[model samples]
Target: MATAEADVPTAALKVERGKKAPQFKGRDRWVFYAMVGIPTGLHVLLVWVPTVGSIFLSFTDWKGIRFSDITWVGLRNYNQIFTVFEKDFFQALINNTVLLVFLFLGPTLFGMFLAYSLDKSIKGTRLYQSVFYTPVVLSLAVVGFMWQSVIYSTENGLATQLFGGGEPVDWLGNQSFLISFGDTYGISKNFAAILIAIAWRHAGYIMVLYLAGLKSVDNSLKEAASIDGANEWQTFRLVTFPTLKPINVVVAVITVIEALRAFDIIFVLNTPRKTEVLSILTTNNLLGEGGGNVGRGSAYATILFLLCLGFVIWYVTNHYKSTEEGAES
Candidate 1:
């Protein structure tokens, strides 16, 4: 019996060594190439081609009409942006910064609070979640219209009835600066109203993201924290929050991107005066009436692109540095 068992082991080893790896040939090889190549081709064609083209076009003067009309201007468009359109540029920059700050302060924190509260498995949790999350699924354009027509309407709007105190408030049309800065740029009342609408939708999105992160947290950690006499806030700050580092990063990136690229809702609301963002400016220059100015528009686009790219680069660099330090430790 011992001899037989030893022979069986040798036979299995020989069989394993003799077995050949499978190889793809002809049809299988073509299928594998297709699986990889198709998506790569599409991504390059759709994303990189346009991006490179836009950067190239930024240095030239073009009316976006014909290739023959394209003129090599070499930084003239950028010069005009900083020199001629300085006011508009700075105003848009200020608005973008304000939106970024507001999103971080208002919706992000509120959403995290909502998510933490909802995670406790209270009664009617689903209904509460649905109520908060409903706005996230709605298009920004629709949300804009709803706010404009139903909520912020100057005449019989809900805001007028509730806060106006028998007086109608012109929420969307008010261009008066709420916080003025040196007679040049300020946060407009209209923009403030728009921010509320944006928050209504954005808070829901943040809530959903946080809720997902909360769900994945191990219950054992919470119980352990509780056993150690940690209060709710202490447990969250020390134990729960550390586990949600990935989600926090995602939320931060999304908030910054959303603030930077805010266009659709403002556009839907007819882009009130004193509320122009970089994206709105890009659209106006690129596709506005009177034969679009391709060069200047492309310049605007490149600047916006660079801002986004810079942030992403910074975040990635910081993340990797921290990761490496952690690994070394």
Candidate 2:
């Protein structure tokens, strides 16, 4: 009886397998092919190809004009980046690092504060949110130019007219270093000016992100904390903030990326001498405006890529590990 029952189950399994796999209809199959193949082809053609080419070019002296002009120079480009052109390169690095640090310390925290306030349903809360989020809607180019002409312009900017008492202050042109690190590196006053504009926009973006995260938190948790005699600060620090881990991670990555990819604003600001960062330097070299060093530009891109990749990988791995632990617990 057991053998007969087993044979019956095996026959049913064989029958199920014999029922052919579902096939797409003629139109649906074509649609699927189009949807997948087009995007895959474009990605391979545009992103991957260019990236690989640039990496190869980084090891060679490619003028970026002719294919035949390419000549492999091994690590010479990287060598120059560290030794020969260390002045601007290191300055760019310092500026990027400073920007990253400042954004996190200033804008990210402030935005969270704003989001926390707004989440409490204050009077005219929607209006306040809109006002803060306006800058985020504007492109970096618009933000840069608007600030340049309306606030930073030496002759007639609001700041110049108001602060200088008629005589305009050269906010963007000032190359005075704020904090000097030896003779080679220091924080530029003009870079600080650009950072202000960046922070204005960045704060709004972070506020929106944090606001979303804040809204999703269970109010019951807050009530429970309050019932337990926990104050607002304690509740936030111990209960609320821990729940915002995902948003915090996202904001951290965005801040780092914005600092690294700060081009449009710096570009519109006339690529100021003192305000040059890695992105601007990379473009300057590749386009021949500064030194036409394609190899160096490629190397700079690679370094930036590595920095971003490292942060992303670390964040993703930690996020998943924590998630798995929480599930197991």
Candidate 3:
């Protein structure tokens, strides 16, 4: 009877202690709250909320001037995108793709060349870096104005005095490069000029990426190849570039995203009505010609956003696939 009474008291004490144990520390509790709250709040506030709102907006005919005036329009906004201005829509898509390729592949290819060449010391390396990177610092407005003024027409412009002696050519209005060959092929001035401008601005940025990638590679491998009597080309193709796969992927993915989102350069070059990119088109509609079609504007924006997301995912996935193989090997 004494033992039984002691056991009952012990059980009671255990139960009381269980009820009174401290739950969490203040700092840890705060961190837990932050971890959950920050990401959840950001996703909801920045991405999900905006996306949901846009979907609803795309279905309405709201001018966005007043909250109470929005009206339901069903698939009309879509119809307008595909049917009313079909040419603009498709042409802009094609142009955007072209821009993506050049803005991405061009920078990748050229940056490798620049990085490889500059990987070693030469005369005035700093000067070359500055010269190449100057365009990057200039605002799109400055770039646009500079190009337009210089290439507007040879007659009044510097090119006119140099090439025509008097008559300035209307460079932007003419086809890209006039061919004198039997089979003449000329690029449109608008595309050509934009291409040059974008390339000039972004090539150096890619070079910086390539420089880092190049640095990450081990030089001992190159020395071993040279000792084996392998030529420079063979060494680079088999050794250095393979190691640079990750950097290339990173640069390409980033470049594609930037290209897809390009607006400022094109906008500064021409009026919204003239350049007519998806971004500008959305802007125009969001402001006016989209009628009171807030939904349509949102739809256009959604398309651009999706396109960028898709390309980024694709490029990054492929990039890492090769990287994983290299890592395993």
Candidate 4:
């Protein structure tokens, strides 16, 4: 049989191989190229091109008018941000830092806990998931309006009804310093309120992410861990959590992006005092009344881009390094 197989003609083998493998030609080839090329082209055109343009504009002085009006300023915009408008810049930066910290501590952890709890096939789990994730589906603008009008309203709002005791508490207006730092910057009461609104929506978003991750976790590992006398927490931390590294990475990146780019809800709330984030400052400078300063806006955008890029690079590098170490071990 080996001799007969070896004696098979090369042309016959080639014909058999050709029967199994097909090649794209004409229309199919064009379709395949379109499927890949269009999206890549659009992404480069819409995302990267604008990013490069922003970086270039960050080093120039322009009123966002005629191209001839542009003048190269060589870090002048950055210098002014640090010197002339340092107060606003620092205030926004602090607010952004606070937001990033809060999201990680509050929503991210809470969402993971919720996902774990819901993954146990408990009664009414679907209903609970729907209820928790409902806020995430709503537009942030709509969420802002809903929270402002119904939940946090000074008059007849649920929050005031529950906590005010009698005097109406301005959930979205009062800017009293809750955590003061000298006379320059502080976490204001209104900003804290906005944080709550942000947390409400963000928690649901995070819960969904973690829930999906949990669903994809293997049951056998969990069963084996249980059989080994590991408690729920231990099993999760060791077995389940380890399996969730990809999900963790995604969640971390998303949390960072969300915290850094937080704008819609705050903007919808008309950007309460002391609640200004980098995005808010960027928008105000880029599109503020009276012509607006393109250079300053681009500088703010560049700063934001750098911050986001820095975190992504750090996290990704650490993740890969740890992964390689684990594999080697």
Best by lDDT: 1
Candidate 2, residues 1-329: lDDT per residue as tens digits? Answer: 45555556555466555455323445555787888889999999999897776778789987767889889999988899999888988999999999999999999999999999999989999899999999999999999999998999889888888888878789998888978888878998888888899999999899999999999999999999999999999999989999999999999888988888888988888845878888987898866455767788898887777767888798889889999899778
Clashing pairs in 1: none
Please tell me which model should have the higher TM-score, number 3 or number 4.
4
Candidate 1 lDDT, tens digit per residue, 144-182? 999998999999999999999999899998989999998
lDDT of 2: 0.86
Q: How do the residues 94-190 of candidate 4 rate in per-residue lDDT, one tens digit apiece?
A: 8999999999999899999999999999999999989999999888888899999998999889999999998898888988888988899988888
TM-score of each: 0.86, 0.86, 0.76, 0.84
Clashes of each: 0, 0, 7, 0
Model 3 regions more than 4 Å off: 1-24, 31-44, 65-74, 151-155, 159-165, 173-187, 271-274, 288-292, 315-329
* Per-residue lDDT over 1-329 for candidate 3, one digit per residue giving the tens place of the 0 to 100 score: 45555566555566546455323344545787888899999989998898778877887878777988888888787788899877667656766777777776686578678988888766887788788778888876687778778755435766556766576576555544332212332234566566777787788888888877888889999999999999999999999999988787787677877777777777766632224568777776756444555777887877787787777678868868988899778
Sort by TM-score, best first: what order?
Answer: 1, 2, 4, 3
- Of the two candidates 1 and 3, the one with more favorable TM-score, higher being better, is 1
For lDDT, candidate 1 versus 2, the one ahead is 1
Candidate lDDT values, in order: 0.89, 0.86, 0.72, 0.88
What candidate 1 gets wrong by more than 4 Å, as runs, is 1-23, 314-329
